[model samples]
Target: MIDKVIEIEPLDDLDFGKVTAELRSKRREQDTIVLFHPSDSCQENLHHFIAGAKKIHGSMFDYGVNWDDLIWDIRGFESTTSLKDLTHASNVLFTQDNGKGPKIKVSRKDEVPFAEPFATFAKAFVTHRHNEKPKSHSNHMVAIKALRLLYQELPNSLTPCVSQLLPEHFNKAISCAMGTQAKPTLYVTGVHLTAIAESLDEYRLTATPMTWKNPIPRNYKHGGASQNRGGKEAKKERAKQLPKTDLLLFLAALWGTYEEIEERDKALVCMSIILLLCGFRMDEFIGLDLNCIPSREEYDKLPLEIDPETGTLARILRIRVLAKKKGHWDEKIVPHCTVDTIYIAVERLKALSKPQRLTAQIMLEEGKWNRFLEFDDDDYLTSREVKEHLGFPGASATNTISTLALHGIQRDPSSLKRKTRFRVGDIHDGFCDRYRERISPIINGFGHDELIIPIWEFLTLRYLNQYTPKERLNVFAEPL
Candidate 1:
């Protein structure tokens, strides 16, 4: 066959295009392991593929020998390199081929890996020189099937050379070919092989004679000493609860010009106080509105009517709260005399009636709402914002408290502003002046209905319920 060029009709002489056209073309969109079959392979096997296109019927009539009729396993496999060498080797073997015999090919030195183990290397060497006859037809099919199954479970990370698969890997593959119906799925098996190959590669790269062991540990630890060496480990855990004093300094520096940035300053001060003391989620403040407060008259009204039964503050101011509960936002009201910090801030804003401070109208605009307060267009300040403001995140109440510590905000059982202890009446006066005295009577009057809103409903509608203590403390105790 090497000296004589046969002039016979090419295989295309037969009108097989129509039959081959019926076979599906196979191509890969990704590099991952997958199965492959020639375009004219069996229609039955095509339909049998787990994820094959459903349009092809497996039960269709089977006929003809065509490229499409050939199927091979290709999962986790790569094509062999140096095809030109193999073609030359095959041609040399074909020189002695008779009309009735199978063609032979010259085997290249590189193709020795394809031959079975224990085969004579000398015989293989000569085969490459003269080009030996092709192996029996049955042996060729078996080899093709073996190659297909091997690739399906082969790890992509492994070198493309077949010699890379270790003895254990080869054994497992052979078992897989003969294994039961419970065999691993294509993905699982392929992943396992890939993982093993990668681990081996990593091990090989790091292996050294000085650190080598015959049987390595199953569970290896990295950076073993550094993990437990530091005293800072314990401190790191406690840092979560410890207050962040630096935050207060940062905030003071940023918003010190309250007059220049009125609305934002007020919002920040109020939000910081609420978050620090109440431990409420930041979004809770996002929903607050003017109706969240009670009027000055109401604060002075006194819930208990002097019945002459007992001379007491008559018709005392009763505070109401709406809060979310049991998966439902609900309304709850209670009578109270002392005023809360939130009430004080609102009252101050009202009393100051400063044009710079945020008002009902200004806070409503989506774009303008965040002007004073630094926030994204979405109106949400992320934990990172809090961390950047302070040294840590703001999501936690504890963090908020520490942030205020630097600003002279004393934290303990009592409510105090720096060194000054506030009385219930003081808080009350503060609330009324900001809310009732300054707010137009018409506006204050209009807010009455809103004050009665259930805490849950209020919360849902952008209103918050700040908690108050049973009695207002007149002084701060340093140690007692």
Candidate 2:
């Protein structure tokens, strides 16, 4: 009722003092007034005034202020806001909406449909997960999409107060998905369904035990490959199919075919090389900040002393990145040679601009960095831009990889050894395999004697020694 009655104050007539006083009076009378300001500065001032009011009112005053609504109002302002501000405000609104919980918009007549109670349960489930177990924005979106799909799939004849969701209904959904959808997609859908059932059971939304199992089988074929092949085997298969020569040819074509490749294409080439060598996820590569690379001070501190035994550079460059899978910040150190190559590539890309940093100004000059203007330099490259550059028509990472592989095949017919297609994951696997084959022997030899290994190799060998065995045995499986 308060949400329905509250009116947005005009930006020109906004008075913080008057609004705060009215809010306090309303609180004393056990009434609510949700105030909305169209200006960010005014909203900040109101927030401060409200804080001060709370201090004076001894914390008993109950005033409800919707931060999301205020942000929406600021965004809806017609003439004053810039496009960048509007985009940022829209993102903020979306994030806030997700935090509130899942919302289902149904008409009055269809409000109590067969899956109506499930919708209610879903809202509660999302709210609880949002508060207790936070997830990434992408994951949240997937959950919401899965719920919507489930709702649409349920039969209309079922009542709102249904006692159970039959297995046949789930089977029907799976059957409908077969041949039309990838196994991974169906698997993820099954996972979301299981999560929903478990949450409902946890919250006592269902009287019967809603112990739903994931219906998607692990060995289900997805594009001629089993989903259960695991990362190592899949990587090995991809590497066998995708010879290093193919990637090399693609790079050659990218750089040498044209007398003067566009600066953006050059940047793309550099990006691809770094991604392949560093085994970076697309998100990790794009998320890199200008400052994330070693600063001059940090570079000077790098161990460059030559090893007496190996007669090689004694240090490697450690580039710190926030890995998405780890859910915490971690560092990825590259060999000195790899670091040098990346530095050169980055410098060349940066040289295209006057700012000498990878900003929208530089990346967008060639119309390559799509949507880069909407974000700050600290954020990762937009998914849209990455997808566009990678030749992926769709938004999914899988699509990007698939398209990249297809493009590689189309561009260099002579380079590919097998008809089997390559994937983004294959790049990572190839890098790791090559590192093991080429660098692992040197490392093993160093271990045989009291050789002074370079710091990078030393660290790398230590990690491999400790983890590689278990990794092979699936002790720490990579997330699919």
Candidate 3:
């Protein structure tokens, strides 16, 4: 209720060391997002948040919040604007207490870059934008960030109220932003600037100049269009790029005669073909279930494509994919032309990857090693049930022992046959540098012992084999 005041406990001076140490660097550590907890007691209740990366620009950066629970949501406040000063902000916001909208948020009091009129306007604008029913939290930050950057760029004397923001201010922001920001970010700023500029038209200050113009040129591209447009030219300029057309052609040609290639290497070719056909992102493809493909009856139910050569119906397979960019479960269907080619590759990959999938499913459900492979720290690999654990099919018994040997898995002379040949505990914990090459979720180019990592890295991660590609080459000595 507006009648009641809300109090947020700030962090103690103990964090003063963290602030001082952080600021002492030649440049601000922009990458770190500081978590300030006001109520040091309960973690489940997340109270406030800051885009804490941007500290108060001047001497005020030294301040710290209560070291316990960081609770900064904008809805609980008494008045949105006409605040006397930043520090004079009223404590009227709370997670549980009810009355909402446009309250003075003490959350970023120290973080504001300006004084009086402009500072109040910035905080009020951030709070108001945050409560806009249509926008998500991320978009709320975009609006707040664009406003802050504009305020920071503008000269100190100009304290243009929220209703008085001009196109010129936006232009200045974009011009300065371009120097520090990537084009994609510039595009987002330009969009919110246009929206904000247009909204100010209704409340334009008659005493000052106003032009509701957008900073981004009408022709400037945003989102996917800009990314894919002229991508080939962009590709040439990037430090790492796909190989030349000639090289790609050679690879495709090599894969064309894949039967002639080693069976162990075919998985890579299969993954490539599957990706090309399905258009799944690397993470999406790798996370697929063994039964990802629908049965023939299911495909038959989908809209049929007419064959070009013959007058008959062709089955279409609509694959459900985890569409990350879209932030939802989505579906994709391969082009009819490559249906048969892709089917074979996917089926082959399924059979090859089956063992890992089985063990991975159980690990996924249990969040740990399955019963067959689970053991005490002193347990030795004395069970024949390892077929339930290892990326079972690709590895042979001999290579399994060799890989185990690489991890310091040793035989106990009192051991039995193949089962007790190696110690069990080390296989999960051991890190072998020579074979540090990890499988890429998209195109798994690296293969040694049929993806049977001694540590079973993918199996170890309980996220259903959401393997990430290695960002850099391993410098460890090569294994023969």
RMSD of each: 30.5, 23.7, 19.1
lDDT of 2: 0.43
Candidate 3 per-residue lDDT, tens place, 1-480, comes to: 477878755765257646533433322233323344222221111112222212321122122222121233322121221111211222222122111222334343333344445454444344334333324334655676566656655554455344334456777877866776676677787778765654333222212223445555433345444444466766565535545678668768867898898755667777676776677776556545444567656666777677554546776566655454554456786677776776677676656555544444333333333433547646666433343354444445665555456655565678777455444545433432212222111112112233322212221112222232221111111110
Better of 1 and 3 by TM-score: 3
Q: Residue 282 of model 1: what lDDT?
A: 39
Q: List the residue pairs that clash in candidate 2.
A: none
Candidate 1 lDDT, tens digit per residue, 3-52?
A: 98878667778556543333212211333332333233233222223222
Counted clashes in each candidate structure: 38, 0, 17
Report the lDDT of model 1 for residue 16.
60
Query: Which 10 successive residues of model 3 have the least lDDT summed?
Result: 471-480
For all predicted structures, in order, the TM-scores are 0.22, 0.45, 0.43
Local distance difference test, each candidate: 0.32, 0.43, 0.45
Candidate 1 segments exceeding 4 Å error: 1-239, 245-263, 304-327, 330-340, 347-480
CA shift of 108, model 1, Å: 53
Over 4 Å off, model 2: 1-118, 149-180, 219-236, 240-246, 250-259, 295-301, 304-313, 353-480
Q: After superposition, how far is residue 263 of candidate 3 from its true place, in Å?
A: 9.1
lDDT of 2 by residue, 317-346 (tens): 666554656644567866656666767655
